[model samples]
Target: MPVAVGPYGQAQPGCFDRVKMGFMMGFAVGMAAGAMFGTFSCLRIGMRGRELMGGVGKTMMQSGGTFGTFMSIGMGIRC
Candidate 1:
């Protein structure tokens, strides 16, 4: 009778090794994906915050100009 060689060239992976390797791979992939998502989210939030701040700054400048104009008018009236 001929003996049959099992798969993996007669060197089967041990249960512990397989489990450990799987856990390591899963952790690595999860971390990579998490980092990518975190970066994307941070960039998106940063862009939005920058846009909001820019708008607020423009409004402040306009308001300041208007206030200066009013103050000038008031000074002229008092003169």
Candidate 2:
């Protein structure tokens, strides 16, 4: 649930909230980076057909998860 704002203004997000936000942002960036790199690598390796798609998909997920976890940890530390 969303937190309510007081008369003064909106309250700052908690540590967990910040971490979550960071993870989401990092995941998106990581996915895009992974997709580009994976495609290039696969093509250079002469991978075609389903192999290319599978390799790209795997790389994207792996990189996204790795980045998200690191980003979340970094954000949490600032709290």
Candidate 3:
């Protein structure tokens, strides 16, 4: 018979890790996209989506406290 885990005592992180990770990823992507939109509107008036997405890449570099809050909420639900 197959066991749920191998020789290691610890099991792989499952639902909660996935939930928190997904939420954090989405939030970060959204924040960057929002910044990209603002850039497209203000500085790059004639520029389009591809150019705007470059700004998004740059914008996502910073880690603000926003994702932390969402992660905490997910953890709270898990507990």
lDDT of each: 0.51, 0.91, 0.59
User: By TM-score, how accurate is candidate 1?
Assistant: 0.42
Better of 1 and 2 by TM-score: 2
Highest lDDT against the true fold, candidate: 2
Estimated TM-score per prediction?
0.42, 0.84, 0.39
On a 0 to 1 TM-score scale, where does candidate 3 land against the true structure? Answer: 0.39
C-alpha lDDT of residue 26 in model 2: 89
Scored against the true structure, residue 16 in model 2 reaches a CA lDDT of: 81
Query: All candidates: CA RMSD in angstroms?
Result: 29.6, 3.4, 7.3
Clashes of each: 0, 0, 0
Itemize residue pairs with steric clashes in candidate 2. Answer: none
Q: Candidate 1's C-alpha lDDT?
A: 0.51
Off by over 4 Å in 2: 1-8
Question: Model 2, residue 40: displacement in angstroms?
Answer: 0.7
Candidate 2 per-residue lDDT, tens place, 8-27, comes to 89787787899999999989
Tens digits of per-residue lDDT, candidate 1, 3-30, equal: 4457755855554555555545554554
